[model samples]
Target: MHLDPFELHRPTSVDEAVRLAGELAGRFDFLAGGTDLLPNYKMHINLKPHLVALDRVSELAGHSLSRLGAMERLSRLEQDPAFVAAYPGLADALADLATPLVRASGTVGGNLLLETRCFFFNQSYFWRASLGFCLKADGDRCHVVPQKERCYATFSGDLAPPLLTLGATVEVAGPGGRRKVPLEKLYDTEGDGIRRLRLAPGELVVAVDLPDGAAGQRARYKKLRVRPSFDFPELGVAVAGRWNSAQVDELKVAVGGVETYPRRFDELTEALVGGPLSDAKVASLAEEITRRLRPVHNTFLAPDYRRRMIGIYVRRAILEAREGQGG
Candidate 1:
């Protein structure tokens, strides 16, 4: 498969990029890493007439302990000792993302905004035509859930769960202006996979900001996928918190790959806080996660198996965090 013809625009500034996006409107798409977008384009998944490449924008490139520019390559960030030490769980997710070559081309922002995937939607044009297109791309009905109104394509990003657990916020620039929101807010909870992100037209993510205290927290990321070498996550769990002796403090848990968005379990966090990190509590938290998630048959794994693994992965992530804290 090959990429469809499109006009490519290289904008040197954020303002210029926003202007291009605004002018093009629904006919355009932002190009950051192109690791995800280009492949989808090649498969004729979603074809836009204009590509606004952010490569020339200098403002989107840099990284510190607390601030990560969206344009920074995943491979670079994963190999950086200081960055790895600062955000170990995020580094772990990055390392487990794709192969080194794909990571080299994938950026933090791209991963954060990776497209939702489904077995039926991500096929060749002929294959999709043969089966009738799904809601995400050309058709209206969702094959995953066989619903007219909702698309059940699964969220497959590996970075979002860890970043959400770390309390990261993203800076976005658009025609309106710049604003920051919690990383979790970037996703549209009520929207289907066809319209998943909350980003407005002409908006571009500038950077991701992590709290200084986030670096000191104990965290772990557990991922389940069919292939260890490289494949989208079937299920992923990320946990972060401070261990006050044997008790939990200010905990955050985020789950992904089994839902339409990476979700932070505020209810579970509230239940676990100020309590001892015991097996019973962990098991209960995992059970709650399993109860909350409803995985559809969009990925390679079976829905029931993925739902069951949610509890297992959550338990393992929390336990690993506790063990990492030397508890």
Candidate 2:
């Protein structure tokens, strides 16, 4: 309920932030909007001694049509008519993250790096201690899987799915220096919930680079949560592609909120790219993806129901995006 005291370091540039991170080593956390990190901190989940606040880093702050800075606020993106029109699925994600109040302070990078969550991990300090620890935080074993090897906490962020569908790339800065990587490659597919991202230690996301191929691609994002607002998604599906007449020119589907990390179905989508996609074909694609998912009972929703709805949400998203026009 209360924040334990910690040293806060404000760096005005990315280089300075990375240097500070190296100095602090494993003892620090990069604070963006603090919407995600602070809440976890208050719950006494993985408390660090130092905080590197990135608010003063002006370089990570703006958005043109082609690039979205890491520190750019969700509310700011949601309000831009041009941006929303250009990346409608991303707009849906931004608007659907938490509430307007939270979104006002929720930065893009924070949400992208949002902590994986589970019923056992996100409890009060006393409650967590009383119940014993989980692998995601203080404990060694996972309550959900009842094992010491892997954690089953679900990926609850909304932006990654839509961004993944767009074939976006991220600019990363660290002690090793700067580089860009495909958005899907940013997630560690082989890692479990406790070790989700592929980022190196002391590295931070700089910005999201929207590729030229992403331009004017029709896209849709569908999220299923406990409520229409505030609650984290139980199932989130995103579909993006361009259609030439009734034939699929390019198609990609990425799903989140139901697994350890958001992922794209490139192989499946690839097969349909050059073919004429009918309603039945879309339905089959959705069912196949749903069948492949293995969501556990980690979040509020039951895994069975979430799994069942995956087919429906994916079907709906693809159907809607196919008809919609941006290009």
Cα miss at 175, model 1 (Å)?
Answer: 0.8
Poorly placed runs, candidate 1 (over 4 Å): 325-327
Q: Candidate 2, residues 85-143: lDDT per residue as tens digits?
A: 88888877877778999999999899998998888988999988987777788777877
List the candidate 2 regions with Cα displacement exceeding 4 Å. 325-327
What are the per-residue Cα lDDT tens digits for candidate 1 across 1-327? Answer: 988799999999999999999899999989998999998899988899999999889999978888889998888898888888777788778879999999988998999899888899888999999977877778878776674578878889999998998889999999999999999899999865678889988899999998878886788888999999999999988888888778878788999999889999986688768878899888988998899999988889899999999999889888988877411
Model 2 RMSD in Å is 1.2
Give the CA lDDT, 0 to 100, for residue 165 in model 1: 89
Weakest ten-residue segment in model 1 by summed lDDT: 318-327
